[model samples]
Target: AYIAAPEKTAQAISTMSPSLITFKLEGDHLNRLNIPVIRRCLEKATAVVVGPGLGLHKETEEALKEVLRIVEEKGIPVLLDADGLKAFANFKRRLRVPLVLTPHAGEYKILTGDTLPGKLKDRIEMVRRAAQELNAVILLKSNVDVISDGVRVKLNFTGNPGMTVGGTGDVLSGIVGAFLAQGADPFNAAVAGAFINGAAGDFVKAEKGYHMLPTDLLEWIPRVIDDPMSHVKVRRSVPRGL
Candidate 1:
């Protein structure tokens, strides 16, 4: 079930083969997700993904506050992204439930108010510090994706340039959310999700080259997860007349 506001966002979600239970907010602004609807949904949800297509508008700040309240009260694992980053950037209190933050470099800078360092070691350290400070897992997306839970940092190299398209990150969050709902620990869920998302992107790259879309990446997800270590074995044939 997806709680989406924008027509295009909703339409994009509709294309996916899931029964979506829609939510309403006044007007085009996704600021106020229906509280009663969301609360009801949370009762059945083991984990929740917030801020996928959620837009950051002035009015929606209140909605984010409500989301936080419900998450805190219910102890639900949540994966925050997009405008949720904006809400998270401003939230000051200590987080209660297991939380994962999926942020790109720009979003990381926005969240911490510090630019990531140029060197790899320093970048890893920076993410470590952010995770430790927030006491949450941070999945920093880059050419080499970094996952850190303050204690350990894992770098993911499974994805390719073909994954640069929009909504791929959303797919990552969804996969992670699924794992968390299925009772995988937060850090492990993040590590596995990042690897699978990137590996699926890599697989899609092989099949469709760089022209693949986020939807194309979806098809490879099950294959990647099922046979994660499997790869196309390149065969070398001798010249026929050799």
Candidate 2:
């Protein structure tokens, strides 16, 4: 709703690559969202991704809630990441739409008020519990990404320290959003997203080491998704977290 920069952001996105990706400018302040332009966008969206660069302003929190209400009515799949997670942290309503949440350790603790355990097994259990309570697929980013949708849990081990750079998490969110848009179930979309993102990161690490940027990992995503098992060798050769 209130993006800080529409023209600059749009220009930047235009240069990133080519396709049918388009963006609308709803003005530069959160209050502009009150004009209800978001409904128009949601009408055509297959999946919705919230957060990324969304600011933590109170207006943003309110705007996100409004978006959630619309999606719930439409039964659209929505993924909450970054600021979207922060906004939803206090929302107390039951939503019927398909929902997915991606939070790193810090965000996870903030979202659920749990001090995430040190051991991997304990951490996975905590995430599973959180998924059950939240009634959404939770993808916890860490040395070994853990994904759970209350009933089924999956672990992904294909990334390296090279993915710590900025924009990498946003890239992961985009990958997950794409899967959801393609009509994958919440759990399946998250599972494939986690593995593909990490595998792409591992591929980038092989060539650029820790200097890889989010863009560097972008080219490898389709490759990884096309032949996910292709990274099995790398996954085995590299120890967890690298």
Candidate 3:
């Protein structure tokens, strides 16, 4: 946010100001925003991730809805995580395009108006049920991840407890987004991302113990992606069906 732009201002100016990434924010604080810039960016985007830092303002929420509306209309692959899920809490829809949602337990409760079961099998089933209800892929964050696209399900057990550090989920979202933009399907992207992210944390734990930062995971991502299974000491059989 430039903080000087007019409310009707929608265009974005790219410069060599040396920033890693830019987020589009408006109003006094997450209020209504004119999204001509976002629209322009979408022109060149094969995939997009919404809600990493997207605030909890009405306009921000509306912007997410509008972005999804455009994605559905235009067939853009999208991943909604973090704050994005918060904005879409309690909303369900069937999208023809590739859409994957990564939500943890709290967000999951808000989404389905139901609680996940304590049993692992029952939990995976509920994740699958949510996917079916929304007609979208879901990657449930947990000690061991459960991913479902309604009919098919997979589990990931590569991550360590050190990943409780902040910014790790954001990093996972980026990895998943990159794969989506590279044309992998949502399910594959989420699975690959979950594995790589957790593996990175595992690697960090080896070198730095539980004193891990999200940046530590970043340093190990390339190695994990280069040969994902190489980092895994143990691989469990993925549960099939429901």
Candidate 4:
């Protein structure tokens, strides 16, 4: 369910217009996502996705903390994106369940406390170190997505420039969350999720080129998932320790 005040709700609704459930905030945005409500909603959730469009307003950050708390306490597998990456600044060591972090270069720097490297090898090593240190899978988004859980790395090459548009990462978080909920391990889920998310973008790009929007990419995800090879030209697997 989408949870935020009216103004935020309008923006979220525009992005997630297809969402089937929504919980609008009545007053303090933080207060709106109280533990009681979180717990109740979690009871029915197989996996949780947090931090998409979650702004850094103080109240929203507080709400993020509560969301993190419930997710940890309940051992819910979760995919953290956007503001959720900011929230991880505090809870990095507290993660106890299967968790995935999707961060672009800037966010990855903030989360890892290191400068993003210029070369591909250095970047892969950084992602690996961050995943190992945090004990979570990391999907470091870029032109060529890098996914690692410290032990293994998967490079996804199915997307295009069109996916740089806003809301694409949110679509990725949902895809990964769905995979995790369906019992894919954190690493494989991230691998497959990255593959699927990018492949969908490629599919949309085939039709719309650089004009493809996030909604188009979102709509194409299932199609890519159902016929992955059709999107990925050559399926190459990275070595276990690469």
TM per candidate comes to: 0.89, 0.91, 0.85, 0.86
| Model 4 ranges off by over 4 Å | 1-19, 232-242
**Each candidate's clash count:** 1, 0, 0, 0
Reference-based lDDT, each prediction: 0.79, 0.81, 0.76, 0.76
Residue 25 lDDT in candidate 4: 48
Better of 2 and 3 by TM-score: 2
Judge candidate 2 against the unseen true structure and give its global Cα lDDT, from 0 to 1: 0.81
**By the TM-score metric, which is better: model 2 or model 4?**
2
Better of 3 and 4 by TM-score: 4
Question: Where does candidate 3 stray beyond 4 Å?
Answer: 1-25, 28-32, 233-242
Writing each residue's lDDT as its tens digit, candidate 1 over 1-242 gives 55645555556657765787555444666555566666876788889888776777766778878877898899898888877887678764558889899999899988899998878799999999889989899999887888999999999767776677888998999899899999899999999999888877777766666787888878878988888776432101111110
Per-residue accuracy of model 4 over 1-242 as CA lDDT, tens digit each: 43433445755665755664555544544454455666677877778887886666776667777776777888889888988788677556747787799999888877878888789888998899889888889999988789999889989876777788898888888888888888889899888888888777777766766777788886777777777767544223211111
Q: Which candidate is the best by TM-score?
A: 2
Query: What is the Cα-based lDDT of residue 63 in candidate 3?
Result: 69
| Alpha-carbon lDDT of model 3 | 0.76
Model 1, global lDDT: 0.79
- The pairs that clash in candidate 4 are none
lDDT of 2 by residue, 1-242 (tens): 22223545656766656763545555553444543667777887888888888778887787777778888888899899998898789774446978899999889988998988899899989999889888899999999899999889999877888788878888888888888988999899999888888899888877777788898998899898789888987666554553
Worst 10 residues of 1 by lDDT: 233-242
